[model samples]
Target: MMNACPEKVIRMMDDYLDGEISPSEEKELKDYLQSCSDCRKIYQELTKTIAFVQSVSHVQAPPDFVQKTMAGLPKESQRVGVKRFMRHHPLMIAAALFVLLMSAAMMSSFSDDQQFSFTKQENLVVEGQTVVVPEGQTVIGDLTIRNGDLRVDGELEGDVTIVNGQYMASSGVINGEIEEIDQVFEWLWYTIKGTFQDAMSFFGGDDQSIEE
Candidate 1:
C-alpha cells in the first residue's frame, strides 16, 4: 500500500505539472510523487483534465451574426431622425424662449416711452410736458394721467392713477389711493378694464337719460 503524502506535496502537484514551481520545490515534489502513489494519482487526474480542456474544439459565432443583430435594431434613418430631433429640440425651445423674452422687453420699452396726457383745465392741467397741481388748488374726483410726470402741490379728493410717469407729491394731500402703472402688461390690463367700465357706464347712463 502507498503511504499518505504531506499536504504541501499534494498542493504543489498542479504547480509542478504546469512547470510553475521553483526548481528546488519541483525537485522536492517530484521526489515525493515517486514515493507516494496517492499523490501521483491526483496529479495524473489534474494533468488529464487540463489536456482534455485544451484539446476540446472552440466554436465561433457565425460571420453574419453581428450584421443580423444590428439589422434587428432601428434603421439608420430612423435613428438619425430621432437623434436630429433630440439635438434640435433644445435649440427650438431656446429660440422660442428668446423670442418671448424679446417681445416682452420690447413691449415694456414701448409702454415706458409711449406718451399720453389728460384734458387740461384750471384745477386739472395736462400737457405734453409734466402735470403740476399748483399749490392751494383742490381737485375733486379720481385723476388719471399717463406718460408724464405729476407734481402734486395741492389736495386731491379721489384716487390718482399715473402711467409711465413719476408721481412727485410734496406737501400735498391725496384722499384716496395712488396707483402707478409703469409696465406694459400692467398698463394694458388697466386700459382694457377702464375701457370696459367706461363702455358699461355710457350704456347705463344712456338708459338713465332715456328714462328721465
Candidate 2:
C-alpha cells in the first residue's frame, strides 16, 4: 500500500491529512489525490481506520499507557510511512492496551470466589476481593492473591506472589520475595505453574511457585 504512491506524493498526502501543508502545497496534494486512485483508496482506508478506532473502541486507558504508547511512535526519518501510519492510528493502540489490562482485571478466574479459581492459605484476612495480612501476625507458607490486591502489614516467612493484582507492604517484615503480575502473559505463566507445580518440582523446579 505504501509503495502504491510516489515518495513525494506520500509525504504530501500525510501532511495534507494532518493539516500541516501550506496553501500551495495543499493545492498540489489535492490535484495529485484527484488523479491517484491508489492513493485515494489508501486515504479512504485510513479515514475508516481512524473512525472505527475512535467510535467503536471507547476504552478505559491504563495508567501511564498514553505516555508509554505515544513514546513508541516511529521517529526515524527513513520510516516516514511507518511514522505517519502510527501517528494517525493511535486510538487503535490505546484500544489494544486497554483490552490487555482489562483482561487481567475482569477475567473469569479472578471474578470467581471459588478457592480452586484462586489460591491461598489460612491465617489471612479476606474482605471482598482483597486479601490482607494484618500487622503482628506471621504467615508460615507462600502467599498467593489473585484478581485482588494484597495489603501486607505482617511478616511472611515464605514467598509472596500476586496475580492480576497489586502488592502493598507496610513496615512489616517479609523473609521472602514479593511479586506482582499485571499482564496476560505473566498470568498465563502463573496459571500453568499452579496447575503443574508439583510435576515441575519433581523435575527440579524450585519450591517457589505460583499457587494459582
For model 2, state the Cα shift of residue 162 in Å. 0.2
Over 74-94, each residue of candidate 1 has an lDDT whose tens digit, in order, gives: 667776665566455745644
Assess each prediction's global lDDT (C-alpha) against the native.
0.72, 0.69
Clashing pairs in 2: none
Output the worst ten-in-a-row residue range by lDDT, candidate 2.
203-212
User: Using Cα atoms with residue i matched to residue i, what is each candidate's TM-score against the true structure?
Assistant: 0.37, 0.36
What's the distance in Å from true for residue 176, model 1? 1.6
Model 1 accuracy (lDDT, Cα): 0.72
Cα error of candidate 2 at position 130, Å: 1.9
Which parts of model 1 are misplaced by more than 4 Å? Answer: 1-113, 125-128, 195-212
lDDT (tens digit, per residue) of candidate 2 on 75-194: 667667655554677556445545555454446555452342235666788767777778889878887776787776877788877776777656777789888877877766665555
Off by over 4 Å in 2: 1-118, 192-212
